[model samples]
Target: MKKINLIIATTLFSITFSIGAFAQTETKIGALIGYGTEIENIGIGANAEFPIMEKLTISPSFIYYLPKDESGIKINWFEVNANANYYFLDEENIDVYGIAGLNYSSIKVKYENSFGLGGDFSSSDGRIGLNLGAGANFNIGSSITPFAELKYVIIDGGQLVVAAGVKFNL
Candidate 1:
């Protein structure tokens, strides 16, 4: 509970900071499909980009991994990330950026006996993590932009994540 609160507070602070620093700027919101190395599964999520400066942006995204079941055990996982992206190469067609961020990961597990013996159990855990990576955005002279990112989260066992999707500017 305390950890969750901390994550919320930190996210709010980053958003506030970005708005305070740049009140008038274009924002982008979009959906993405992601792959996580630790879970070896694909996830789908939403993301938003808030430009804080000409070459810097604050991005927040969430990813939920598809639940997997094996041998009567089920697992569910998700992550929330707030990252700062520094664009090294900003162009009309493509924008490349470096990433650094905070990550919060949670996973749950449930087990059930197939024989219907009434013996079942469940468990869950959450952890705070850090991320570092790089990504690029492609603009085709429209309101919609496609982007791809590869980031590694350093936390509880560590994981590599890759995402790609389109964002709409607004």
Candidate 2:
């Protein structure tokens, strides 16, 4: 729908802006395992470090979460995020950075909730939200690097999250 299109457009704009303003390094792709209150998920992301300036990078990641409920029912959701990373400490092969950007998320309810008269209600929607986080990366001996990140969404009640992943330099 319109909202989905808007999310795609905005993401493209940001990636284009970053590429224009920063010289890009080689491309690297990785996967992640994330844990959050009320949810557990897995993610895959790509990293693009800026050329000439190694202190900055851009990361685009996608995630899918399993359903959970008090009554042992499942509720699924998915999200995609693009973050701008600024490294405060850039060592030989290690870097710790701060992140900020946009996240587009969609929630789907697979099971219906029973009403007072045993009726069921279910719904699904997509939301474009803000993302902010920080992470540290350590060079694992060679071209491989391991990283840990923590991010939170700017939702009304807030969504706290943590992730661990590895990146391979291309």
Q: Pick the candidate with the highest TM-score.
A: 1
The residue pairs that clash in candidate 1, if any, are: none
Q: lDDT scores for all predictions?
A: 0.89, 0.70
Can you write out model 2's per-residue Cα lDDT over 43-77, one digit (the tens) per residue?
Answer: 44444443335666677777767555647355767
Question: What's the true lDDT of residue 71 in model 1?
Answer: 88
Candidate 1 regions with alpha-carbon error over 4 angstroms: 1-23, 116-118
Worst 10 residues of 1 by lDDT: 15-24
Candidate 2: C-alpha lDDT: 0.70
RMSD of 2: 4.0
Q: Write the per-residue lDDT of candidate 1 for residues 1-170, one digit (tens) a residue.
A: 57766766776676567655655677887899999999989999988889877898889888999999978889999898989999999888999999999999988999988798888899989988999999999989999999999999999789999999999887
Error of 2 at 164 (Å): 0.2
Q: Model 2, residue 56: what's the lDDT?
A: 65
Q: What is the lDDT of residue 107 in candidate 2?
A: 75
